[model samples]
Target: MAAANSVWISLLVSIIIVILFIQAVPTAHSQNDEDQLIWAKRVVSGNQVITNLQFYFHDVVGGRNPSAIRIAEAPQTKNSTTFFGSLMMIDDALTVGPDPASKPVGRARGMYGSAGQTDFGLIMALSYVFSDGIYDGSSFSMLSINPATETVREMAVVGGTGLFRMARGYAIARTYWLNAATGDAIVGYNVTILTYV
Candidate 1:
């Protein structure tokens, strides 16, 4: 009878301790919770601003200090008609004009790979880092497949930082100049971005 009473008393104390612990622990809706895992609230919408930018991309692949360089490639990349599987790292210049001596605006830094086996398609993942005028310290990112032979190519401006926060839009690229011997080129970009003001 004494042992049974002791067991009952111990069990009752354990239940009380568990109950106190549960009450001490914070729940999702606890009022005194300083840290929370989830939150939801409504925010005002339709405060987007559209910005249009134009610039020239100078891809210097032939000079002693080339801006773009081939980093990796498949065994058949050199002989492949489309240069498929070839990857190149680029830190090309963004200028106000097509001329290489034009005013410097920014840099196009990224990697592009020839991904198409039959077509001259390049998968580009580039960031346009700006340091001129209103877009100073701002950068926009692009990830798209560019059909190299197309007269005009369209690329998505997925996101951005600084002044272009939450940016989304498109960019149009056109060949401004090319050197057949050196494989150098100046490409013009017209980008339209919609960002949160």
Candidate 2:
């Protein structure tokens, strides 16, 4: 009789401990929801202006070598791959020439992969950096732009630095002018940024 009572008590204690453990364990969704709530405490946003984004792209193997693979690959490109860089003058107008006194607000530089890489329209990945004024050192990624189309283009702003730390946003790239023949162009950008600042 005493032995039976002791066994019953041990079983009851095990069951109680199991019940407590089950209650303590949190579901995946509950943990994810809690994290989301925590990150929402801070967020700041503003518009970033960039204008007269200009660059010249050239491929040497295409033209200099008569027996080259191809001078370019595009509407009329000579080189399939090229490394290029540009200074985006910070002026608001949609005109061709930026004011001489206007400062270069950002930088656009990157390499172009082969045309076979269908991931991006332009098949190039570029980085934009804010060098002067209030946003110095804050840089963002530029995803891709299809050179074939001249309509309002778009690029993704993945992340940033400095005042724009932890920033994420998108940019509207408008092709003011594009020379399919020479791969030269003038573009404008209006970017909306979200950050901790």
Per-model TM against the reference = 0.75, 0.47
Output the number of the lDDT-best candidate. 1
For model 1, the superposed segments whose C-alpha errors exceed 4 Å read 1-46
TM-score of 2: 0.47
C-alpha lDDT (0 to 100) for residue 111 of candidate 2: 44
lDDT of 2 by residue, 1-197 (tens): 99999878876865565455434433223322432221111122123222212211122222343111222335433332332222122212122123212334555544444443323244545566656545557566655554535476666676666765665666665654545664444554555555552
Candidate 1: residue pairs that collide: none
Please give, for residues 1-197, the per-residue lDDT of candidate 1 as tens digits.
99999878876865565455434432223323323311111122245455667678998889799999999999999899898999999999997666677667899999999999999999999999998767778999999999877989999999999977888989888988889788799997877676775
Candidate 1 to native Cα RMSD, angstroms: 19.9
Compared to the true structure, candidate 1 yields what TM-score?
Answer: 0.75
Worst 10 residues of 2 by lDDT: 37-46
